[model samples]
Target: MAWSADKSYFFMLAKLLTYSIFGIDARPVEVEVDISPASMPKTILVGLAEAAVKESTHRIERALVNSGYTRPVDRIVINLSPADFPKEASSFDLPIALGVLAASGQLETSLFSEYSAVGELALDGVVRKVRGALSMALQARANGKKGLIVPVENSREAAVVDGIDVIPVGSLAEAVGFYTGVLPIDPVPFSWDDAVEEHGTYPFDYSDVKGQEMAKRAVTVAAAGRHHLLMIGSPGTGKTLLAQRLGTILPPLSAEESLETTRIYSAVGRLEEGESLLLQRPFRSPHHTISQAGLVGGGSIPTPGEISLAHHGILFLDELPEFNRNTLEVMRQPLEESRVTISRAVGSVTFPASLMLVSAMNPCPCGYRGDPKRQCHCSPMQIERYLSKISGPLLDRIDIHIEVPPVPFRELSARTEGTRSETMREQVIVAREAQRERFGKDGSLVNGTMAPQQIRKYCKLSKEAESLLKAAMEEMGLSARAHDKILRVSRTIADLDQAEFIDVPHLTEAINYRTLDRSSWTQ
Candidate 1:
């Protein structure tokens, strides 16, 4: 390599890396760069460079010059570490530009090795926030890096990961100055206790809902057991109101669960600016127009879908029958397994989707098929077709299916006097605690997700209850899956009452919840 006229002998080598935020799990990547003087001046970035990464050369060059740094008029080759793993995004711009400047003897490269760099560089040299900041910070910390230089907007998101030092900068120069000690930067501080106290609970409390005692009880049981629930009713029957309040009754997520939820939001580029951790459980309600990929994830590099984003939270599907059949069908596997595996030509990525599914649909297209006041205009075939949109297997996976009747004028106008969310939440918390003790530390083994062995062990029914369930299953033509679901739901009801065994009342509630499976109604 020929030396420049300055003969300062620029030899800056910088660390480069990629970040993986599959769902909420963040993994680090290594990026390495080398620059040299050659007759032809060109810059090439290798290591599975995606479109955004390949386009970074221009952005980096402009950012460097604008930031009072010169781009070496030499053939430059920048290689991202782990050459086999794919690189995506404009985050590589700042690192590549800094590396080139340091190698050209324009800037010092000594401190570059100690810190992980992540930010999108603008044409005017501004460092923009990139997606997956939390994941990047985690990767940096895991690799034993001292700290991370991220964009200001992403500082809070990255700081959520404890023990990692996150240095927020406005532009490339600020990062360079901090690293070179020209300007000292402080790490963003966070306190989980403060976050909890500040974000106590949701603004929409359960007490706000009125005249749906049965529905409220169902919500409590579902929240306690993390069971999937389906509500059928005509329009304006308080289905959505009931569904919205379900989150308020649920217990707060543990620290680990909160982090897992935050990571997924970070990866999908949905994390709010300057927001650190998502203390509350997520509630994702994708529109009926959503495609299969939009619901379950897609792409050459698969990303999380709505269900994954709703992990550790609720996924409310209002007007459920309106959703595409194919889209609804895709949820069957994830609902059963509590995770979704997205397969592409590159590889398969599994995202956690352990969400409480709350879906609402009308009895028929006109939404008045079963109403006493209004006549059902639709034919029998129309009703059957609308209901058929949802598959049997998917229906069987749901633990509770109740009819939500519209409140009468008297009830709707009645004074609001119901249990507050705090009160219901306390009860739900107690019930959940009871379950946690029975199921152990792993939250996945809740009553709704119990296996055959766990069901037999925990859901030991009284002789009368067992006979009632068997008779109900045969009479309703319920599948084996439905039978299992009934047992799980009955166990949850029993747990709510602090009952040791499934009793007659618990079995009755469980059987009543299977409203859709009743042959007379569908017929």
Candidate 2:
């Protein structure tokens, strides 16, 4: 049970599997520990480890002695390979500790090669949760590892990743007992069906808003097709309310999407302890005072920004004009590419940012420019300056632009609710199913994400629809990008109507959404 010279290390070497998260994905690493009795009585951690691991060997020694094991009296060396890359996470602590115990003959274990382990260690030898446990489990499964040993708090999160066993350990002693076959451990239970049973439940619903049927319709279309939307209105017109409830009408994330999204959340350490797969789509509403780096993701070691956090979900910008122009402008590339690439001097990382951008802004600076109840106090210059903050190119990227009118007093006080989120959610689901069928083979997810090439193939228009779109383009001074957006929106309208072809009515309805393109707005 204690350290013995006969059972002690002669050819003492131990290597185990571990993982490191880079951006939103993970890569496997091998933790190798070497123990030499004849060398100096010191511990050294080498091979490009970060500052956090500088005292790792010392901590491992302390943890070993504290966990009722004799500390190795000889020299110690720990190396995490691939040695060329930077290792910065605290996940290396567990593997390093186990490797030392095995190499020092305190623990007779050979499961290190069969199982991957990731966790931080306390001086008292307790195993603390590490970030990206789910990501590590996935890497372990992909690399043909049989099982994963993680902190007890992370068992549920990593257990959801199928095809591998998850051994939850509470302390370093418990982990050593399991590895040495001195104790028993069970893998946690998690399933996809159990994760998605509570999908459509939401605290905010469309029925909460009295009037704004047009705004609801526009938002439904945007969700159905993954389109970006902009709502221009005065204060207290349900614009913010509508934006908040957009995700309620969206379908739950698919199994593949759930894994991908959960991995992203895990990598960022945003996932709560013991939480499994994230079935609900994310809805991120960042403040207007955010900077370019926070909005688009940039740092010494890059991190995911708000857009990436809102992946496969909505990014709502309320009071859009209040945001700094350059900060808002950072979204132009990700809007087109559905991904963000942040480059550092050492390396570059790319984060997925596929999301529905729903922004709301007042009609003017005073918030009463077009209100029938309130008088406008701002001059034309102030209005122009506020509107100018949002660039034309940026506006063109958005598919739908509509005005939210003030709700009537009777509508506000009426007991009878208008259309509810349940009704709209069903309709949106139907329309999205239609799009999934239409773009099944071409690899396009939604009409709004279609490129010009996919647009030419799937968004075919009838003659009547073509003529209407042409006249409206000329009258509104629409750009080519705007033209494509209208076509995409029109395609979505047809999908909503359950029609196969884009008819003239769908085209008219789509063109009507481009309210900012009209010359009267400028006048």
- Give the distance in Å from residue 171's predicted Cα in candidate 2 to where it truly belongs: 0.7
lDDT of 1 by residue, 211-232 (tens): 8888888888888888899999
Off by over 4 Å in 2: 1-11, 198-200
Candidate 2, residues 1-523, lDDT tens digits: the string is 2333565445378889899877777878898888877777778788788888776767777888889988777778888898867778888989899888887776777788788899999998999988888889988999998899999988888998878999999899999989988998988888677666644256788899898898889988898898999999999888889988887899877787777777888888898654687877888999999999989888776888999989888899999999999998999999999999999865899999988999999988899987887999988898898899999878878899999999999989899998999999999999998988887775447899888898999888999989988888787788777889899999999999999899999999898898888878865
Backbone clash count, each prediction separately: 9, 0
Superposition error at 105 for model 1 (Å): 1.3
Instruction: Please give the lDDT score for candidate 1.
Output: 0.82
Q: Which segments of model 1 are wrong by more than 4 Å? A: 6-27, 474-477
The best candidate by TM-score is: 1
- Candidate 2: the clashing residue pairs are none
